[model samples]
Target: MRRTQLRRWIVGAVAIAVSVLVFLVPFAFILITASKTTQGASLLGFSLPDKWVLWDNIVTVLSDRNGLLVRAFVNSIVLTVASVTIMVVLSAMVGYILSRRQSRWNGVITFFVLAGLIVPPAVVPTIWVLQRLGLFKTLPGLVLIEATFGLSFCILLFRAFVATIPRELDEAAVIDGAGPIRLFFRVVLPLLKPVIVTSIVVQSVAVFNDFANPLYFLPGDQNATVQLTLYNYAGGMAANQYNLLFADILLITIPPLIMYIFFNRQIVAGMTSGAVKG
Candidate 1:
């Protein structure tokens, strides 16, 4: 039995190693392709380049006359930051109230939130509503759209985590003449660290990589986001510089890659910490 378990572990490790290679190989090709000359890149040579064009390509992409790539990058950051901030606050507040205070409508609220998990967004209707409200084609409109999508998930996480926090703290603080605001911010919020960290990781990745919302709501050359910037890689006059295009792709992908590497463990812990006896 011990030998069998050991063999299973070995097989699992080997499978994981191979999976990593499969996932990383394309990215590896991107780096090599990005550094190579146009001829070398086109030849599919998977070795060091004789003439490095890395810096030149970077400058060209960055300094494009249209300034679309850089503008898109900045827009993505704005969308991600604003969306995440609103999501965290709204979720935490709603979660706290639902978990901490007793209410007759709690079940209805929970049902609604769970239903959102399965609901495919009605995009055309959403756009029409936004337009009616005069929120079309604007940064604030996009931010609100992201926050709305994130609301249910954030609230779910917050409630699950808050349930694990001892209710005695609230009672104790109240006995000491503390108000609800003080009790939550000064006492309870600090204890929700694990779950908050988890939400941050999950929501951040979603908002950063969000392509559909940006495409639908903020569609324009000037408002293009990072994911949209990949269109420049098309195999035509626009996609002439495959090397530079691959390099720009590499640049756009790096920040999220670094974040996941550093915070993946925390993300998992936060998501699950409130699940079981939290």
Candidate 2:
């Protein structure tokens, strides 16, 4: 028993060390590079800089192109908030219905929802559809695209969580003269806090970090997002403003990092809370 215990302890220690290295190494490199001069950052070595220029890099990134970085921040925030809000509410309602209903069409709907996970989106076809709808190159169009791509996953998460909720709750709400909307808002939504928080954090991070969807669906200089600011700092083959690029990367990365740090426990609980049946 003692030998087995010692072996387990050694394994756990090694796993923890590996995990730390995996996260810390890249983050440390980014931090070091962000603190260097443009020439120093171009070297891309792991060594500490002789002269720290972290503040200068940040100022330059923020002030470039008459404050394009600020505009990108605003665009990213709007996109994330709008897309996530719509995705969560719609997915929750759909998931609840799918979880409770036993109709024939439910199976078909479920199949399609799951198919979204398996299938890749066709960009050209989507662009054509968007153009026909008069939504091409619009923020609302990008919001819809983000929501559609995320709906399947969010619905799956909510459906599993909703299954773990007892039907008695619904019956009791009905007995109290609650309608569908009222019941969902008052009883079901309150109970769904963990999963909701998980969805919000996960989807918010995904939308905020999204580069391709914004680039393809909402292409415009005025519509640039935080991720696109990287291009501004290091554009074309000749441009090599490594210091500003790293600084921009670090700034954009901090929000999601803080979100994960704060909501990590909730995310774990939300993911696992519905796994076991009572």
Candidate 3:
């Protein structure tokens, strides 16, 4: 018993050490660097700022290029909300259908869904298609791209969780004269709280933090997402504005970090529910 307890304690300590080194340490470094002067941050040392100016750095970042950072934040919020909403609704409907139905096409549909997870997006082709559709460099275009890219994973998550729900509820709903839409919305969706929260939190982070997609699909300054606005500090004054750059990174990172912190338990529960057998 003593040996078992000692081993558990050692493992727990090791995990804590790893977590601190991996997450907390890098965050501390960012905080310290973001607090420093231009030359101090340019040095990129992990030590504390000689003269802390964190608020000034934050203000400069926020007010730079006529409040570009503010615009980027609004664009990101809109993109994340629209993309996640589309993903949740469409994926949930598809997941419910896939879970409840026993069609012969299930295997083929499943193959394509799995393929979506495996296949790297063809950027050039996607760009060409978007241009043809008059959506390139548009927020709506980028929203669609984000939604499409995230849909497969969300579908799989919803599908797995849907399987855990008893079908007796479905039968009862149908008996009560509920239509297909009514059945799903009134019955299944409410019970999908865990997976819905999981999908929203996970996909919101991904969409908000997405750099490559917005860079490729939405190029204009007018449509800049928060991640793309990082380039504002990368040229001309790059050597002198590392502090502002880090401050911008810190600003954009906070929303997703707060989401994860608040929903950590729900994420674990949702993921575990999808993992175990119904």
Query: Each candidate: what lDDT?
Result: 0.86, 0.92, 0.93
Q: What TM-scores do the predictions have?
A: 0.90, 0.97, 0.98
Clash pairs, candidate 1, are 164-278
Pitting candidate 1 against candidate 2, the one with the higher lDDT is 2
lDDT digits (tens) for residues 53-154 of candidate 2: 999889988998889989999999999999999999999999999998879999899999999999999999999999999999999999999999999999
> Ranking by TM-score, best first?
3, 2, 1
The local distance difference test score of model 1 is 0.86
Clashes of 1: 1
Residues 1-278 of candidate 1: C-alpha lDDT, one tens digit per residue: 99999999999999999977887888888888888877777777678888988888877777775777889889988988899989988899899999987888999999999887879888899899999999989889999999999999999999999999888889999999999889888898888888788787788889988889988998888888888887776566765667877878888888788888999898888888888885
Question: lDDT tens string, model 3, 207-241?
Answer: 99999999899888888889988898877757468
Q: Name every residue pair that clashes in candidate 3.
A: none
Question: Which ranking of candidates, highest lDDT first?
Answer: 3, 2, 1
CA RMSD per model (angstroms): 2.3, 1.3, 0.9
For all candidates, the clash counts are: 1, 0, 0
Off by over 4 Å in 3: none
Minimal lDDT window, size 10, model 2? 232-241
